[model samples]
Target: MSLKRRSFLKGAAGGGAALATAAVVSAPAQARPNKVMPPQAVGLLYDSTLCVGCKACVAGCKEANDLPVDVSTPDALWDTPLDIGPKTFNVIKVYAEGTADTKDQEKNGFAFIKKSCMHCVDPSCVSVCPVTAMTKHPQTGIVEYNADACIGCRYCVASCPFGVPQSEFDTPTPKIMKCEMCKHRQAEGKIPMCAEVCPTGATIFGPIPALTEEINRRKAMKAGEANVFERRVIGSGDTHERPAAKYLDHVYGEKEVAGTQFRHMSAVSFTKLGYPELREQSYSSQSEGIQHSLYQGMIAPVVVLGGLVWAAKRASHIEDEHPEE
Candidate 1:
């Protein structure tokens, strides 16, 4: 081969080799495991059977977060949102069957389900965010959004399996909005507004351990049996008496997506309550594995770039030797 031609070929070979090496090195790293929830994580336990669809939690959320009204309909003068949006951080969605005669019954009944962030143990929003806009607290396990750090990218919105994070499209300076589990209130020795205002203990906030225990207790309860559930927060010394509805054998968010800080329980199947059926493993685990494998230490790109530079330099040297043939 001619010297110039050889130089070009050498460069191409080097670049290809570098890329191949990078792929080989990254493959195993991409198989890395997903993250687990923090030991002291705090979150909400939403019992659909206990909910009365009063929307007190919705109003409290708006008031606590200082969020504006979401007028869903043109003629509607109230802040009645159809779902969780920028203006409506927490919403009560209804699932009605034929007749809608009874509450919590799947057939011929209507049921209420709360919609908000799941606050995933391994959050896809936090994983996908290019900027540090979405973050999870180590102690509380609350997924939070920082508007100042956000670049208005809807990566979080697209990544969330629960469809929690919502971007503000109406305003000029748009921000992604979602529930933070009232961490601000907790900082001030108060509970989340949604939990605080929940009269039926539908939405209870507490440490994950305690909540898990409560979930187990409730799950074991006989249907139609009277049970006393703690209201607002666990260990808050507040209790309420009510008859337990027949609970589905599963708990939403318990193991789904490696689990979520916010757990859910219901009489009807979670699918009927508008929950997306998700695998126990997290998507972040797979995505991050690929990402880390390829760019763990920025080694792959640097190696590839270095190989390209070396090739170009060799090609230039060959041209200089040939004197511009």
Candidate 2:
């Protein structure tokens, strides 16, 4: 073969080999295990069965957080929020089907679901933050955001799986907003306003272990049997007696991304109450693996292109030197 022909063939072969190995080269790395919860982690136990669709918790959260009222209607008379927004940090959404007469019944009933941050053990927001603005407390496991450190990038809002973080759009200067489980109250030795004002004790706060125990106790009670539930926080003297609703075996936060501080239990399906179906694996692990693979393979294409360009240039130079008969 002529020198030019040999060079072109060699370059083509090299390019072909690079293309063939592209998939293997770009394959993501193995995913790591999800993170575990902190020992002294504090969170809330929200029982959907016990909720009465009252806006007391919602009102209390707004007051405690010093958030402005969300005027959903044109008149703007009352503080009516359709969902958690920049103006509203927490909300109670209702799931109704058929007649909706009975509470916590799927066939022909309704249920109330509390909307707020889950405070995930392996939070995506904390992982994706460019600055250390979004942080998960090591001891308490509470996720907090510092607007001063934030550049209003909105990466936290996009990374969150539960759609908890929200950016204010109405004002010129916007900040990300989410529920921090009333951590400010904790400093003052007070519980979350939402939990304190919960008339049915639907929302209770305390250490995760104690809350888990309370959840187990409620699950053990037979359906339609009376059980006394503690109010505000676990070990709180305030209590209320009510018939236990049939609960699902699965706990919402328990095994989801290696668990979350805020846990939930419900007689109705979580999907029916607007909660998304999620796998136990953390999304960060999967994303990081993909990122690593891409980083490794980024130079492959450049090398292949360089070889092709060099071969073309050499062929052109030889053609000019040796004129065709």
lDDT of each: 0.89, 0.86
Question: Model 1 — TM-score against the truth?
Answer: 0.87
**What is the alpha-carbon lDDT of model 2 when measured against the actual structure?**
0.86
**Model 1, span 1-325: residue lDDT tens:** 3565766787788778767776675546644576887878998999999999999999999999999888878897998899998898899999999999999888999899999889999999999999989999887889998999999989999999888999999889999999998889989989999999999899999999999999999999998889999999998889988888899889999989999988889988898888989997799998888777777678878877877777677777777778758
Model 1 has an lDDT value of 0.89
- Backbone clash pairs for candidate 2 read none
Q: Which candidate should be chosen as best, given TM-score against the real structure?
A: 1
lDDT of 2 at 36: 85
